[model samples]
Target: MIKFAFCYEHDDTLSFVKNEVQNCLRQREIEISVLCCHNACELAQRAHSGCPDILFCDLEQDDATLRSAIMNVKRANNRLICVSTAASHSAHAEDILLEPLYRMPALNRKHLWRYAALAYEKILDEPASFTYYVRPSYLRVPVHEIRYFASEGRRTHIISADCRDTFYQKLDVVEDLMRHKNCRFMRIHKSYLVNASFIAGFSRDYVLLTTGERLRISKYEYYQMLTNQLKSLKNTKLRYHPSYSEW
Candidate 1:
């Protein structure tokens, strides 16, 4: 069974996306629980109690409002995978999924189903480690060890804290592969795929990687990154660590 919760301001758009989502899930014979929220407060309450596996949010709202609502939901359900219905170009965050709502003509029912399936697969078959075959060697990389990936012509560079390797693969293909395995890799640019954990800061033109590399980002990407950062910071306080004491 898959549970979904939606937060949207416009009722018509909400109905459209929800119907698409429900129809696809039904085809797969998956039982679903749909919770509709009109405001951030309602969304937060549902998140706290229902803890839906997937959260779909409308990005048409004001930045401040969306940020607040996203933060509230994250606080309640840290594990929830959020999908956005706007800002198509930004791969700013790891947890929040971005799907262009305006491009509904291009994104048909099949695309929506694929998106839902991807989210479902992440929840069901998340892997702790990912293996990639570098040209001369095979590396079994831990999901947490990856920092980012950069595409160079026909090769892709795997950048991490300990090592960097180049492999023959396209950025999009690599993105899908990692995503299927539940790795938090966001495509910040056409040539760059970034790990959300390594994003130090970002501006309208660029994203500052933790390693001091500034990667170019589109305007939409910047907005998405900003929203993601806000949600992450808000939920940081709720994250627990066994090694650290509360005091």
Candidate 2:
């Protein structure tokens, strides 16, 4: 569910904007909560407490003060999508906001609905492509091309299909970063992190990659992996063969 906070100066247009946004989200079967704030300070306070997914603010007020308040709110919650509504604004305001500003004469259902749809797309869509920056020349390497990472002293070697690159980074730090960013790297050993997508098979103490590379795996981790694989295969079989229940 997406939560939205609306900060506008005019009291009369508040209901209109709220209803339009609600209706737009309802049509898409998305649940949302909307909070209305009369001023920037109120908006910032609400954002600091609720950490809303999106914030819509009126930009017709004192530009300097409003921008500063918005920046504070953004700093408090980096994930909040801050949007500005203004009929006209100076280039300086645009630079300050940094995000796209909606310019409309009056708040209407159609325009607000379009903006809501756009926000949904921007936040929810995930791209399949992944890249890692190699140091020195700083070349962008596609993550899918890499098979595994092996720790060699202070430097980590990236084994890829085409070429190998060496970078100075801890294995654990790279594993955490990749996992947080939705990469398929899994740490199966103390000194190695293998991409799960490229894993062809596994045994008691080793993992076989699609490239025919055998990587060492701890006995405990290998058992854990085997259990997880069995559970997954059982679930798949149950889903496909409902009547054949014998495991």
Candidate 3:
């Protein structure tokens, strides 16, 4: 079962996205849980309990709710996928929908539900795919593409070597998917959760990724990562590139 939660200010928008998205998903036999939140803190609390798979919101949610919700989501799930209905000043959450409240088309619940299901289907089909729940919807993304997720203040960003595509997802969703896929993602820093496959080499204090991204490797788990990496490669048919040093 794929669970979902939606946090939005307006009742109408909430109804529209959830109805459309969830219904579409049902035909495929996916289960979802939807919640409507009026306060940011309330939503944050939900995230802390266990971040949902997807989080769709009106970025224009009252300043206080927006701020608190953003913070809560980051603390709980940094890779969460967010679909914004308004242009939010919130640094971490990005704008997904193009138009503002009045200018946007009427919220279509059916459409949202179908998209939700389609997204899930994609996840189930991909070997590297994982699932997460938003309040009213569920989301899935490829894990290998993610370099790391970091939080700053109340905002968080999904960092990847391909700066051209900074895919945004609710932090909670990221955590959920991480658990389901059983991938090698580690919360190395308070602000960072990294994919182990990207790691090229490591020492007690830091890790070097093939992408050339240097990540802090805590002394507590550095050796464990080395062991895990070795095991990860044991079953694979690995071949060295010409540039790879022959050890």
Candidate 4:
């Protein structure tokens, strides 16, 4: 069943999102369960029983609180679909619905329903698309290109294979995804979430990545991964794990 959580600033706003979600679910005959939160802090308790497939929050809530809630959803393995007035401002969300309706300052029912249906369609039919999630800066590099992750002050940098395009993503989210045992990602450092298919060699404390970048590996995690999780990645056809080392 698809589950959803809605956190809004007002009752009318909550009603609008709910009505839209229900209308879409009913038409598709999809079973769904829902929980509602009036503010960001209230989200924690509502989502405690189980994670939602989507979460919607208003920008009027405190920024710190909203960010906390977003982080919580990510940590809980939940994908977010936000509803807000400013699409540009809420660029962080995976999906955003901007409503021009001022009557009750609520989301447009048709738009909201269409968005939810589309989300469900994507999740069910295109789960493999997540592999391309590497940031745009890294896209220019060859897929087999190995890289380094290092931290400076407060940010994490993706040192390129050629030591040039050192793009960065915050360390927090990277660290969170690393903790999942079933997740295909492995953490070579506090700042990196390396895809297992990228590793070319391993010896003692270091792993030689396909990008030819050598990175330190936690001894415990290295052993655990090698013995348990690494094979599943290799068996999958997600990426053509090229046999040639110098691709």
TM-score of each: 0.46, 0.48, 0.41, 0.44
Give the per-residue lDDT digits (tens) of candidate 1, residues 42-110. Answer: 876666676777777755444565566666655665656666644555534522432212212233566
As a whole number from 0 to 100, the lDDT of residue 247 in candidate 4 is 15
The residue-by-residue lDDT of candidate 2 on 47-144, one tens digit each, is 76676667676765556666776777666666557555654545563444545344444567766886665565444433333333343222445556
Ranked candidates, highest TM-score first: 2, 1, 4, 3
- Residue 14 of model 2 has an lDDT of 70
Q: Which ten residues in a row have the lowest lDDT in candidate 1?
A: 238-247
Name the Cα RMSD for model 3.
Answer: 13.7
Q: List the global CA lDDT of all models.
A: 0.64, 0.63, 0.54, 0.54
Off by over 4 Å in 3: 60-64, 86-106, 109-115, 118-247
Please list all clashing residue pairs in model 4, or write none if there are none.
145-211, 146-211
lDDT of 3 by residue, 107-214 (tens): 455436534643454334444654444445544556666677765644456665553222335454444446444345656655566676666666666667677777
Off by over 4 Å in 1: 88-110, 128-247
What TM-score does candidate 4 reach?
0.44
